[model samples]
Target: MRPGHGGFITVKNTLLHCYCVCGKIEDAHHLFDEFPQRNDLISWNTLMGDYLHVSQPRVIVDLFKEMCIGGFEASVTTVLYLLSAIGELGSYLGGESVHGYCIKMGFSYNLHVVTALIYVYAKNGEIDLARWIFDGVAVKDVVLWNCLVGKYAKCGMVEEAVALLLGGGLVGELSPGEGESDVVVDPATSSLNLNKSAEESTPPKLSQP
Candidate 1:
């Protein structure tokens, strides 16, 4: 049986696991604060992961910053968490700085890190930078290709989107490419198309909801 009152690291890990499983982040923080020993990297990252799972991604960034202030060396997983949070937050400057940090840390060669960077840049309206990253990947997957193509189409870069379709490099599982792939239209894409029509319509000033 585990001790009722263990060392701070052990208690922190137990609380973190409980938080992750039960999804009670507030209680987790309470336990974290009650511990006398400073939280190690695992404690910080575990809590950060819990925040990510809860869709409160922006919290992950603040957690990472606090980890740094506490003198904990961030793991690659911590960097990924921060990047994911930045992507969700649409904080382009923060994302760019994180990207540079990853590069300086020699995590530039890590595929997952690179992909997150590309995705963050693309989602933040830097599609060209996303494309540069995509092209540099020696083994491009279908998901990466689809992300690049869809972003191009979403941004009204129709020609580039078409070129991606025509390149036949990779085929996505959910959304298909140009000719014979049989694509399913999602509501968001359909609504975006409708918005584009509204912008191009006669007089161009349509009623807003």
Candidate 2:
């Protein structure tokens, strides 16, 4: 009897671990419900991590909502994974919602989670939001600082770009424009005034929305 109990417990634990890694949440939950005891933090986080891993990012957000509604307390690991999944989706709205959750849960101090928040905002074209997150990160690394500057520059914030560049963030490098090519132009095409000829040859087409 003792040998059978030990073997069963080991099998159960192994199955739970696999379920989390493989993102088989429904199966894991079913097994958990059938087991006599299965409410450990590890088990809970494993299930959440699997949900984040297996589902598309948007679906992962829904899973997080379900977990929150179910009154399951989240660990730092779980929140970090959730933030990363949100960033991966590149959805500003979803990231914002998760940010609210993080604030409410007092997870605002987690460095990894904060960095994920910044990356999510930047990827979603919300440089202002990303800067806000970066400001809160204590002793922000040079890489993180560059992310904010580069994001602003990419979004066409010229003055902001210059400011960041002056502050030691590497700004855009000077490169030759398309017009600076060294290849000799064909005589016929070169002699033709491209702008005037294009205008004379064809009128711009209008498309109905």
lDDT to native, each model = 0.64, 0.55
By TM-score, the best candidate is 1
The TM-score between candidate 1 and the true structure equals 0.72
> Measured by C-alpha RMSD in angstroms, how accurate is candidate 1?
13.8
Candidate 2 residue lDDT tens string, 1-209 = 13246566556656766876676767876775575354444455455455555654555566566666766776555665566566666667877887887789766665545655666787788888777676556454444455565566667786985675576534444222311221111111321122232123322122222
Show model 1 residue runs off by greater than 4 Å. Answer: 1-11, 36-38, 172-209
The best candidate by lDDT is: 1
In the range 126-156, model 1's lDDT, one tens digit per residue, is: 9888888777776654545666777777778
Clashing pairs in 2: none
Q: What CA root-mean-square deviation does each model show from the true structure?
A: 13.8, 19.8
